[model samples]
Structures are given as structure tokens and as C-alpha cells.
Target: MQSTVNYLWHTDDLLGQGATASVYKARNKKSGELVAVKVFNTASYLRPREVQGREFEVLRKLNHPNIVKLFAVEETGNSRQKVLVMEYCSSGSLLSVLESPEHSFGLPEEEFLVVLRCVAAGMNHLRENGIVHRDIKPGNIMRLVGGEGQSIYKLTDFGAARELDDDEQFVSVYGTEEYLHPDMYERAVLRKPQQKAFGVTVDLWSTGVTLYHAATGSLPFVPFGGPRRNKEIMYRIITEKPAGAIAGTQKRENGPLEWSYTLPITCQLSMGLQSQLVPILANILEVEQAKCWGFDQFFAETSDILQRVVVHVFSLSQVVLHHIYIHVHNTVAIFLEAVYEQTSVAPQHQEYLFEGHCSVLKPNLSAKHIAHTTASSPLILFSIANETPKGLAFRDPALDIPKFVPKVDLQADYNTAKGVLGAGYQALRLARALLAGQELTLRGLHWFLEVLQATCKRTLEVTRVALLFLSSSLGTERLSDMAEVRGTQELRRATELRTQLRALAEVLSRCSHNITEAQMSMGHLSSELAKNRDQVHEDRSIQQIQCCLDKMYVTYKQFRKSRMRPGLGYNEEQIHKLDKVNFSHLAKRLLKVFQEECVQKYQASLVTHGKRMREVHDTRNHLRQVGYSVATCSTKAQEAQENLSKILDQLSHQLLQDRAEGAEASLLPVTPYPIPAPTDLVLHMQELYEEMKLVAFDLQDNNRIIEGLNRVPSAPDV
Candidate 1:
């Protein structure tokens, strides 16, 4: 071997052979510094010229600390082996933990934060540099005992990653099966008889699965009679089912009366562990992916949900119920919003995945009980929208009273008060007071607490709408269909969904009203993003972002476009990014430009068009007056006189003239970007500016009426 730098290593001890390359634990010949060396299979690599060079370019540019550093590559003209030297891990891969029984106590909650932070930091850096780590999995993650809890962790392997921040879009089959997302099926030539996409999101899925295994003692989707034997495990893993009453997920505790299925997990484990894991994986893995949380947002959403409603959904009548409307609405909004963000930020193939599922178009679920969002009490439906601006809206649908004794599944224990069961509740005090002498003091106290609690919960739920509004949202086709129809079915469905959702809007709007003046006073930096998505063009980065999205989608659909695989939108988060949508992005750009330029002074165009219309109307009236005068006098030559009168009226009105009638030859000059009038043309391009404003003012009431009367329809009539 040729002599090189002291840190360089030379070794032939092959650690493992992947489909593309053989990895060797190497060491520097001079410095004795250890490194992992990956040598590509000479025969296979030679056949894929683009992938080979692309990987080289992508890895060469990487410099993040969390990522496994690639030091150098060596190739000789005569030798068939091409090797890449990378950082080596001593404690071994995360896969070691999954395969080991004693790995239960491998990482504590606080300790895991370090690994997560490192991964996030690396991902942030890569995204900043426009590189996506396309393959994230347990095998690729390595942990070392740097702190008390084996805290130190690093992400290895960027072999399947891409740099679509540029104009290029690559469509290739890639990624491992355990973390493979359904949309990935589109681009993937699934080595097995399964469907998958080989996109950046696959890395996130793998990371999520890895994290789940790390956090819990078991795989989220356990093999019921192993996949190698029964195929159910294979199906479950492939299909990406919810944790669905699994060992680590569901538990039954015997209370004084009976036992109930209790929720005892994190928010990431919500909507089935698969959905939770998929989004987390996307955030950690996809470089250009949408931001899910900062430390605060993640824990706020996670802790609040797991502790109260999101996970276990404890205390419907007392705590969770008081905010059940908010919880349900916000849950729907957040889930939908997450989906939108996912679709927007995801790599092409895995955009719509929340769990392992793609965003399958399911019919809208009908809520048996009307969800009352007004702050009165929890769990119980209160404050129905009995009347709407559309004249008393749909008569309150008969709410199927859920058969219950108002018993909530509290996580707390009454024997010693350890579960979510609250002995400190004031409602029970008020109830006892009512049962005895009906003390006004206790009733007043309960009322105050009830209203205060409802108000707070209402605020939280309502703000959720803002977040949902932040996204392009889901089932837009339903909205479109609702807008055009007048049938009973359309009205009924539209009224219900709109009322339920608007009850969502009311929550946000009310919350905004009560937000402390201090918070309202701050110079919100996020206002930059808030500049109406309609006028998002000011963000110069949008086009670049859209370009990357287009490429991702293309890469995701590579297999299918070539008849290799198939898919729809995502099922993970069950939403789509309007920005990621090709037409939507383009339309938004045009709408922004149109608003800023054409519509900014759009009142002028309205004036111009309206003025022209009025002139035509006035001319017809004058011509009619003239024709009436002309009609009276010449009775002997009535036919000729009438013909002449008609000609004169046509000339005066100009309606039957050169502009509207193509056949009429005009002596006037023709200009496409016409200065409609000669004098105005000479003055300058000034008058047409107010057109949009004029149109807006005139149409404002019409718009208000339409919006007031129209409601967004359900996904489908169930």
C-alpha cells in the first residue's frame, strides 16, 4: 500500500458485507488510528456510474459532528477495490441493543435526549447544507457510554442520501425493510414481494423504529409467530399497523369495580406506535423535512398529551372531558397539520406517511355526540351551535348518548392516590354539597373552577385551529364539492363538519382575544412566516424549497412511473403539503404575484372594466333615445329608415362593434398590452393600479355572504 497521512488506516478484516459494499474495521498504519473502511463491490459499483459519483460528492461535502465522518477515499487504476474511510464506533451499533435481552435499561429518558439532540443537530446541519440522510436505522446508529447513561451517540451511513436542494431529482430503489414506508414502495423495487419507496423518509421510519425499540424493551410491531414462520409479522411490519393493544402499549388494571384498557405511553406512541414513530423519524432524518418541534414544543405536546388526554385520555368529565372538544379538535388539527408539514417537508416517496400507513382516503368519521367547544364544562357536550348565519343551520342531529356512568379511566390510584384519579377534585365537593344542604359557597366555587378550566381548555383547543390553518389542510376536494352543491346530503354533511371545525376556529379566536397583552405586544419573529401563505413569494427560499419537493416526489414515484411500483399520497401523518404540491406551489406563486402586482392596485382594473361596461350601457341608452326619435318621422320609407337607425344604434353602443365582434374590421390600431385610451396611454401606466381594490370592495359583501353560508364538507358521506 502507498504511504499516506498518519491517520489513514489499511485493513482487510471485513466486518460485514452489505448489498453494495464490504465494511472493514481498519487502522492507520502510521498513527494506528482506528477507522471503519467501506470497500464497494467492484463489479456492482462499476455498473451504476451516477450513484457511485453522487455518493462521493454528497459525502465529500458533509462536515457535521453527529454524523459519522468520512475522511477519505482511495482508488487505484489497476485495483478493483474502491475504499472509503469513516469514523468507527467502539460500543457497537444500536442493533446490538435490539438483539440483546439486557438492553432494557440501556438508555434512561434524560440520557436519550443526548442522542436525540446529537441526531437533530446533525440533521439541522445537513438540511442547512441541503443534504438528506436517506438511510436511518438501528444498524446505522451507534451509542457510547460517555455520560452516566451511555449518552453519547452518532449517526452513521449516508450511502443512500441525496442532495436534491439543487435541480436534480434521483429516483432509485433503496432502504431497509423494517423502516420502509409505504410510499417508498413507489420508488422501490422491493427485493421481496412487498411494496415500498426508496426515499429520504425511509431513514426517518427506520430511526423511529430504532428509537421505539430503544425506548421500550420490544419491537413496536412484534412478530406474532415470527415473519419467518407465520408471515403475519411480515404483514404487520409491512402494513405498518398500530401498536394496537401491544405489551408496552396497553394495560389493564383492576379497579375497585372492574378493569379497563389503560393508555400508558408517550405521544409519539399515539395513533398507533407506527404513526408516531414515522413522523419522529422524518424529523430526525429528512434534512429538508418540516420542523416538528424544538425541545419545548416536543415535550409540551408530548408531556401534556401523555399526562392528560393525548395518550391515556384520562378524565373525560373532569379534566380530559372539560377539554375533550379541544382535545379532539386539536388532535384532528395537529394530526392533519403534522401530515401537511410532513407532506411538505418529506422526501418525495414518504411524504404522506404518519405511521407506516400512507394517507389513505378514508370516509370522514361521524361524531355520535355533538362536540361542544364553548368553555362550560369538560367531556359533556355543551354549547351547541343551535343557530348559524344560514338561518338556524342543520337541526341539532340527534346525539346518541354514550352509555356511561361518567366514569373516567384515571391513571391515579385511590387506595393510595397514585394514578390519574384525582381526590383533589372540586366537582366532587360541589356534588357532595348539592347532595346535602346545597351550600351556595361550594356551588359558586365549583362554577368558578368549571368555567376557568373550560376557558383554558377552550383556549388550547382553539389555538389548534391556527396551527391547522397554518397548513394547506386535508380533504380539500370535499370542500370544493361542498362549495358547488346545494343538495340535502351536501348541506347536511357540510353543515356538520363546518360547525365542528368552526367550533375549532372559535376556540383559537377566543384564545387570541384573551392572550395577555404582554404576549400580544412582542415583536413576533414568526410573523415572517405568517405573511399570508397567499403572499409567500417574498420568501426567496420558497422556489428552492418547491424545487426540492418536486424532485422528492419524482424520486418517490420513480418505480411507478417506470411501472416498477405504485402508491398514493402519504398515510403516516395522513395529510399533504400544499407547498409540496406542484400546481399548488405554482398557484401560490402566481397568486402572490397577482396580489402584489395585479391586485395591489386591482381596484383600478375593476374601475376600468366597470367604466367600460357603464360606457357601453350609457351608449346603448343614448342610441335608443336617438332611434326612438328617428323612428317617428319617416313612415313612407319605414324599412330603410329602420335599417339606418339600427346601424346608428350599433355604432353608438359599440357593443356590436370591432372589439366584441371578430368579423368587424376596425380602422383603429391594435395593441395586446393595450393602453385602452390614447390620452391615458400617453400620460403613463398609472390609472390601472386601483382595479383590485375596487373589485375587492364591491365583492367584499359577496365574499362575506358566501363564506358565512358555505361550510367545508366532510371527507365523504359515511
Candidate 2:
């Protein structure tokens, strides 16, 4: 084929192909320089028509070290083909690097940092030029290899790039879904109202995702399986907290833990690095586009942590100590620095031992007696220089270190030890002292735990005794027998009243059981609430508890409404036999009968019977009060149970949705405890029911007295 532009086409060097474009390795015939030629198929409607020429226009305006440079563009009228010649990246794209066998899991943190810095620079350049790289993913990031782990990554593929006005929101949902922000999806597909257009922050989010991929060969949110899975992924992106999304991430066997959204770094990372990196990732992955970090903010924040080197100092005779604050890379200078700071010896007087992990950091023994030791791990150890080993032989060995106090001095010595440990010391003596102090503290805590356990057991025992006393009081019997009823009409009326009382007692008893069942349910629910509150954000659990309480309140109101039923209320008009129920009149009438019929013989027995009758009467009144209490308490307990169920259901739903570790077994519905409220009510109600039954039986047996006391009952209405 004839040359379309100044560059001669190398058709045989087929680089790569997309649906709408074909890229080839080409050379400028005049300069004999290698370049990439992308020829767009204008006939394909898949790509926007504006993209055919806008990419070249955008690339021409951009000039940055990390951005690919455009040479020239040519269009053939006959073929209707548009071709653009641009800079060639010999090492290919970052996609290749990630897919390579050597780096399949992910690039090392150091190497990935280089890639990130370059990408950020390129994107910043684009932003400065008022352009947004709509499709910023791994395939578009090109890499050029250089010497000694040095590589220049250039942002390529401007086909989807667009220039926007300030404060503009990108309305289109065109980028890869995994990288797209939730708001963009909502605005484009879901059509959620009040959604502002996404801007450069979109790029920041995509970059964060790209960074995550570089650090770990996986996406934070991946679409899996079929149609249902797609929706689930979308829903998760919208609702679930990003930190929780990375719960299933596992650390690689050889490399760092998967740098996920929750916790990006591993425990092996120094405190300083962790402090720096956590904030950076948070800024980038923030769901709100407006809040995401700009390139300048990202670079400024991450520069220190990314560049800082950790130095692990080990005293061969003592324990290993990690020092991360040191910025100086030169081992001799660092060694001298550490000598003055860490030990009480001078650099010239001390002989140091240094070991290196990488080629650049190899310790040159000839220069400073530093030994070249290779380490498979990233831990870099530097030994404290020993000055005069023989001089220590003259010093008293026992006096050299302080003895551990078997008993901590509560005054001056304790304060001094506490201060020393709090400040922390590297000396072997101090470390040993700290260990001894810790042991003492642990023992103290153990003693405290034992005391607490005893206290709890004692409290439980006291509660049990109180419950037993309360329960026993309800079932106590009176020491008496029932007097006889003499009249048929009086006996019939007493029997009817007794039958009604028994029915009322049964209803009250059922209420007690209901209340108890509810209370037990709520008790179990409270336990579940305690557990779920720990795993989730406190706010969510708190809100859930409030909702349950609200439901319980409503249920309680309903129960209270039921308590006002006419059957539960006492009706004075419903009482038929007032003479039998009126203890004052019955006592006078019974005394008159005793006086008339063999007064001398029955006088002593009459006194005992009167006392017993009064006791029985008082017991019956007490049973009535007990029944009322059971009804009221049972109502309250049932309401509590409803609330408890609601709270438990909330917890169960959260547990299932979150699928938190160790929660798989909780997928089944929560089975509430057998509530004590109803059972306690049952006990009280049963006692009242039995007591009332006895009162009714006695009243039925008193027919003789009831008739004899009211002799004119059959003659006329007295």
C-alpha cells in the first residue's frame, strides 16, 4: 500500500485492533523514526462521529511528559479512512504488564508507585487543558521501559476524551461499569432526579480503581454470573459501604495483601506509611465526585509516604528495632546518625554491621566494613555498632541491669517505671523491664476478672431469691374452712358470681402468658442487637433499634386499648347477692344464728370460725388485686416482645445482607427465647384462679348461713 502521510505504513506490524480502529507500528520515511498509526473505520457507528477527529485535536493541544505526542493526521477521500500517527510505547500498555507471568498477581508497590505518578501527571495535564479522559482504564495506559526499574508511562487512547466547561457534569454513561461512579450510573441509566453531572472527579475515581488493580490483580467490585448478578453488583455499588466491599479479599502468598478499598496496606507496612497511604486511598475512592482528590492534592499528600524508606535496625546481641523516620539513604551517614541517636557510643569508636536487600543498597565492606548480605524479604536490618566489648567485663554484671520488682512500688519507683515504658526505650534493660511490667499488669487484670465474675454470680443469686419470694407469696393458703349457706336463693346467687369470677381469672391468666412470651422474645432480641451493633456502623444499628422501639410502642398502645374492654372492668350492677358478699352483715347474721342454736356449746368454736372467715375474705380480696396486676404486667410484656421481634428481624436482615464473617449460620430466622413475662403472669394468674376457685367453693357450701341470716328472702324483697 502507498504511504497515506509522511509516515510509511508497516502493515506487517499489526500492533492491535479495536472495533472502530486498527493500530500499527509505522516509521517516518524521512526521519526513519518509529511511531504508532491508528486508522479509524469511520463506517462503524459504534464510535461517536465527533471522536473521529476530536482525538487528534485534543492530542495536538496537550503537551506533557506522561502524555503521548501526536505527529500528524491524514485522511484519504476515496477510502474514507482517517489515520493519526502518534508516539510509540515500546513496552506496550500497563495491561500487558499486569497480565505478564512475572507480574500477574500485581506489580510491586515500588514499581506501581512509578506507574501511578506518571498516570496522575498525564491526567493532571489533561485537566489543565480542560479535557476529561472519559475512558481511563488499564488498556489506555502505555508504558515505556527504561534502565533499572525506571519506566515512563504515557496516557494513550484519546478517542473518548472530551473537553468540558468549568463546573460541568459529564452526563453520559460511557466508561467501563466497574470504573464508573455510582452517581454517573444513576444519572444515565437509573435516571435519578437531582443528580448533577459528573466532572474530573470521575477520572479520579477511575484512577483509584486503576491503582487498586495495579496493587492487586482484582477489581473492588466485579460483575459476576448472569443477569441477576449484574443487578446485585449495581445495587452493591449504590448502597453498600466501599470499605465493606473488600471484606472477602485475601492476601497473596508471596506479595502484599490485596490493596482493597477497606484496608489497602498490610500489617507489615510501617506506621508512617500506613498513616500516609490510608488517607490517600480514602480521598481517591470517596463515592462523592466533588470530594475526590485532585491531582495536586493526591501528589502532595502521597509524596512523602511513597518516597520514604524504612530502616530496620537490629542489635545482633539484642532485639530487632524498626526505625522509619530516617530519610537519608546512605548507610554510612545513617549508621553515624543512628549511633548518636540510638546508642551512647560515638560513630568512629563503634564498628557497625549493615545488610542490604537490593542491588542499589548493597553494603560495600571495603568502604566502611559493611557486609553484602542478601535478604529475600523487604525487611532491611542495620546492626548497632559495638565499641568496647572487653570494657563491659570490668563493670559489675548484676548492677548493669535493674532487677524486676516482684512487687511494684506504689510510689516513686512505679511512677518512674511507668514514665520510662510510656516514652519507650530501645535499651535491652528497658525492654526487659517493660515485659515484666506487662506481666504484672496482665496478672492484675486477671484478678479483676475473677472479682467481677464473683460479683455477677452473687447478683444472680440475689435476683433468684427475690423471684422465689414473690412467686411463693401468690400461692400461700389461708388456715380456714367455709361456713354453710342456709338459703337456696342465696346459694344460687353465690354460685353464679363464683362462676363469673373463675372465668375472669382464666382470661387474666392467659394475659400473663402472653406478656411473658413477649418479654422473652425481646430479651433475645436485645442480645442480637448487641452483637450486630459491634460488626456494623454504630449509626445503622442504633437507627434499627429505634425503629423496633417505635413498633413496640405502637403494639403497646393497641394492647392498652384492649385492656379497656368492658369484661375486664367491674360492674357494680352485675353483683346479685350483696348479703353474702357484704362481710359486715354476714358476720352479724351468722352470730345471731350461732346464739339461737346451742349458744353455749358453739360459743368457743364460733370465735375461731369468725376469725377464720375474716382471713378467707381478706385472701379473696388480695386475689382480685393479683389478677389486675397480672393483666397489666402481661400487657406491658407483650408490647416488649413485639419490639424485641422487630429488633431481631432488623439484626437478621443486616447479618444476611452484609454476609459478615462468622454470620453464615445466622441466615435462618431468629428464634426468640421463651419470655418470662407471660410465664410469670401465668404463675400469678394461676394462683389467683385457684384461690378464687376455693372462695367460690366455700361460698357454695355456706347455703345454710346465707338462708338463715336472710330468713325473709323468700317471703318478700327485704
Candidate 3:
């Protein structure tokens, strides 16, 4: 039957019916706009006048995206019944969605997050206005499809809502029995003879139940029988069970009662997400009123989760889908690392396509940008490549060393060697005048040789052990191929260890080589001094030795000014300053540069290449599928094939144009043949290049140290 309200709205379609009122889909007669007309039944008018008018006042005051909007309040033309004209939602309530067969277990994680965000936002708006919704459940929440086909949930049916501050309390027994707090359930459902005022936290209990139902497709605190059938037992269970324990209880027709303390196996949420959500549920679902979280805390926690959670859909071969969960604050580098951990695909080999376009994956790319790009089309094509694409190469500042061998001053090096020999000759004479005599000098030289030999021997042993372990970890089958190095955490640690050990070995080897001639000269002078230990005039011998030392010092000063091989030699002042250099600080800066310039840049290139390859692979597979379907002679198939063919033709034309514009094209054999996998020679070459750069950096660092050493003054010429 058609009805008219205030001669402005004409109602014909029934939307829903409840205990107090019935809603109908209506249209405004003047402008023909669709709306929902809610008419209160006569029985509802029996309540207090203030209670009867509260819904209208509350609805009128709300203006949030997650709350239903009120248009007007009027009376029926014939019977004078009160009617509320409000914004209409084309889709039904959340209860209807949960009732679908596919959602028998629960709403998927994506849909559940949407429901959670919307409900939390709507309730936050209510609290901001000092309003309390006594009823919060799936049936009271309405769903509507937005312009972009996204499901938007809105809180509706505010008949039981009223202005109540957080500190204030009301003694009304008005809420669904199953979702009521233990205090409310005892008084309202079991008819306990007591007066208990409900605080704002009562709403939190109902919201917890609603979210639990939306996530798990069942109410929490279920008894063997239904809540109404065994009301006393249900009350006992709700009151006696500790907070966050007892997820639910169930019983078959003739089986034993079973209790579960965790989410069921059928739930689609990942463990990472569940870890975050369980705490929120624990806090809000507290049976102890004092321990329960307030709306402020709830809002803060939910808002934080919304800011950090990002769900991406990755597809391998368009058959299987992986729902990857990540955080919004993660960078592209961290995101790729997470992907590698989960999928076992090296960051260098992964390719992806987002929204039918190839993405340029840069290491510093923000997760926010990635989430935005995939918002409309979340399905990303993923693939693996046998080799890196040429276009994927990126410029790294660490690899920009000039291509020239450092020059050496052979003549100046010879002079420095000769001066050192002459210094040794004068040192034997000076030892006779010394108070400690030749014994102390001989002991110092012996100690120096022992320490140097021990250091060199220990370094060699450690290097050999490290090489053995590295070779064993990487089997002999691919000894030189780094492409087979899985991007695992263990492998990365091992690689770092190898680099450090190799550098230490090289340093020890060079020091041992440079000091050999000096050691030999010192040994010869020590033997000669021991053989001729005659008592000489102390003052005269000291003066003669000092003059020889002065001459040798002058020769070294000239040698220090000339260009020489890095780490070749150092003067007395340079050696003294070397002990004061802050080596740890310099090492930290070098590590920072390597990470930012080399590792991150390479990861970015891998992601870009992977995405492009995925695009091409997907397009080709789609074309093949459409062509096969055309054999069925179906009209839809024929149209799809035709469209795909046109796209392929355009791509061919574009390729030709590119070739004409000076892009080189590779030709493939016409006949089908088995193709061999490409060797990892390029990967090895890259590794070599990185090692060379590290060596160059070390040499430059040594040069700087030498410069600092020269700035310090040597002792005045004797």
C-alpha cells in the first residue's frame, strides 16, 4: 500500500521493521529524491516524551561520513504518525552481508578492516557530541556502495541513543541481551532484583561484541544453549570468565561442550594482523568495568592501526593470490626485504605490475604512495626473471672512482730506503752511549718482530677459515656465481664477514712486506754492535750519532713531500699521528655510504625491472587466453579477441617506431629450440666492481691519514 507523510514524501517500498518502528523507501514528491521514511509505531509513544524525541535530536545533530544523515522530521498526512526522513542506503545492513553463504566463517580481512574503521569512526563522532548509543551491533549498521564501488558502513537506527557524558550513568535496561555487559545482563535479562547504573563503558562492551561477530561470524561468550534459553548459565559464564579468555563455547546436538580461547582456524586474518587486533579486543572486552578501555583510548588505538596497516594483493601466474600485509611507514627497501622473507624471491629478481602499468620501484619510495597506486586495482602481477634487464641499471655514487692507476715515485722510494739504512748504522753507535746500552735496543727490535709475525700468522689463519666456510656454504657447483646467493639474513651476515676478513688479510700482508727490509737492516746492525762493545767517550759518540740522524731526517722530509704508493711508508711524525686517528668514526661513514648508494639503489632497480616484465608476461597470457576462447564461437569471446588483437597490433607498431628512432632490437631464432639459462658472469662482474671501489676508498682514506700525519711537526734537527 502507498502512503504519504506531510504531503511531501510518498512511501511504497518496505525497508525494514523493528520493535518500535518500520522504515520504508520513499521519494520526495517535489524534487523526486529518494530517502528513507522511519515511522514510529503507536506502542513506542507510550514511553517518556523525552525518550520519544531523543532519536530525532541525536540524528539531526550528527554530520559525519560514517553516520547516517537526517533530512527532516514530519507527520503522516492521514494518521498523524511521526516520521523521520533520512538519507537512504541502497545496500542493506551489515547483518545481511554476514548472512551470505560465502561469509559463513567470517568477513575477509579487507572487508573486516573497512567495517572496523567505519564503526570506530562513527562511534568516535557520537562520543565527541556527548551521545551514547545503547545499541551497537551488525543489524544497526547500514552498508552503502560509494561512487568508486567501495563498501562504506554507517551507524543507523539511533532510537535508543541519548546525550550522556562519560562520567554520567543511566539505569536503563535497553540493549540486545547477547551483547550486554555482565552488569546489564544480570539486571536486564535475568531479571535480578537490583538497580545498577550503566556507564559509557557499556557501549564499549556492545562494540566489542559487534566487532567480534563481524570478524568471526559468531557472538562471544556463547553457552551450551542459547543466551535466552539458558540465561542463568550465560550470565555466570560472562561474569566468571577472565577478560580476553574464553573466546567462545559451543556444543553439538549430542556432543560435549567445547571452549576456544583463540580465533578459529577458518579466520582469514594473518597472524601479524591478529597480534595487533587481539590487544584491542582484550582491552575493550574486559568484564571488569574499571579495567575496560574508554572511548578515547579506543579511538587512539584504532586510528593508529588505520595509519599503519597496508594490505597488498600479489598474484603469481594469475592463479594463486598472496595477501601481503605491511606497514605504511616502511620504505620501498624494507618492503622488498619483507617480500623476500615471505616469498623466497630475491629482491633483485622480483618484478611487479600495478594497475596495468609498470612501476618504477625506487628504494626510497614511500609505502603511502604504493598503497595509493594500488587502491583502485589491488591485484599486482608478480614474476621472476632469469637475468637483470639492461634498463634496470642505476647510478651509484660509490662506484664513481676515476679510471686510472695511482702513480708511484720509484726514485724517491729508493732514497727513503737508503736513509733508513743509514739511520740503522748511526743507531748502533748511539746505542754504546745510551744508559740502557745495546741490550734495550736489541730487546725492542726483537719484540717488534715477534708481534708483527704473530699478527700476520693469526690473520692468515682466520682468512683461510673464513674462505673455507664461505666455499662450503656456497656449494662447489656455483663457486663464482653470486646470483645463486639467496637474499636470506644468514647469507647477508656471511657476506659482511667475508668482506671484513678479506680487508684485514690484505692490510696485514702489506705491512709485513713493507717492514721486511727494515727488519733485516736492524738485525745486521744489532749483530755488529754486539761484537764490538768497547767503552767509548760518551759525549763525542752522542754528537757524531746525532749529526748522522740529522742528515737522515732531512732525506726523509724530502721523500715525505713526494707522491708515493699508498700505505708504503710513513715518517716519525706521521706514525705518531696515526695512533690518534679516529678509525671507528671513519668506518661508520663508509658503511653509511655503501648502504645508501649501493644496496638501496640496486634494490630499486630490481623492483622496476620485475614490474615491467610482469606487465609484458600478463599481456601475452591474456592474449593467449582470449584467442583460445574465440574457438568456442561465442560472441563475447570474439569481441574480446578482436580487442586484444588490436592492442597487440598497436604494440608491434610502437616497437617498429622505437626501432626507427635508434633503439636496437634483438632477433630471435624462428624455429623452436631449447634455450640455455644465462651464466651469472654479469653478477660476478658487479661484485668485482664493488670490491674494487671499496679498495679505492681505503686508499683515499690512507692518503688523508698521511696528510694529517705530515701536519704534525717532527723533532727539531739534532
Candidate 2: tens digits of C-alpha lDDT, residues 258-282:
3244433312233334445566766
Using TM-score as the measure, name the better of candidate 1 and candidate 2. Answer: 2
Better of 1 and 3 by TM-score: 3
Against the unseen true structure, what C-alpha lDDT does each candidate score? 0.38, 0.47, 0.57
lDDT, candidate 2, at 293:
69
Using TM-score, give the best candidate's number: 3
* lDDT string, candidate 3, 1-718, tens digits: 4456432543447788888899998888777788888988898899999999999999988999999899899888678788888888889999888754335456878799999999999999999999999988898899999999999999999998999999999988788899888899989888887877889889898998888788876787777767777777688767766666636554643334454556765455644456567788878888887889999999988887677655454433222233455677788787777666545566665555554344446679876666453323443534333333332112232232111112434444433333333323323222331322222222322333333333334333333332333233222232212213234344344344444444443443443343343345445544543442232122233344444445544444444444343444557436423321322223234434344533444344335434534443443233223222211112222232233333333433444555477652232222234322222333343344344334333433432332222222322211
Error of 3 at 614 (Å): 26
Q: Candidate 3, which segments miss by more than 4 Å at Cα?
A: 1-12, 252-259, 311-326, 330-718
* Candidate no. 3 TM-score: 0.48
Candidate 1 displacement at residue 94 in angstroms: 1.6
Error of 1 at 261 (Å): 11
Clashes of each: 48, 16, 4
lDDT of 1 by residue, 1-718 (tens): 3223333333446565677877777778766888877777756566567767776787788877677788888753345467778888777776765444223322433344455566656665666677767676677777666656545667776677778553333456567654544345323523354342233344445555556556543444434443244333344343443322222211222211111122223211223333433444334322222332333343343433333222211111111111221243343434333433322311121111112122221224322222222222212211111111111011110121111112211111111111111111111221221122111112222332233333333333333333244122222343333234323453445444444444433443443444332123221312321332224224333344344334433422432232222323454112222212432343344334433433333233234323322433343233222222211211212222233233323332342344466743343334343323323322221222132123223333332322222221211111
Which candidate leads in lDDT?
A: 3
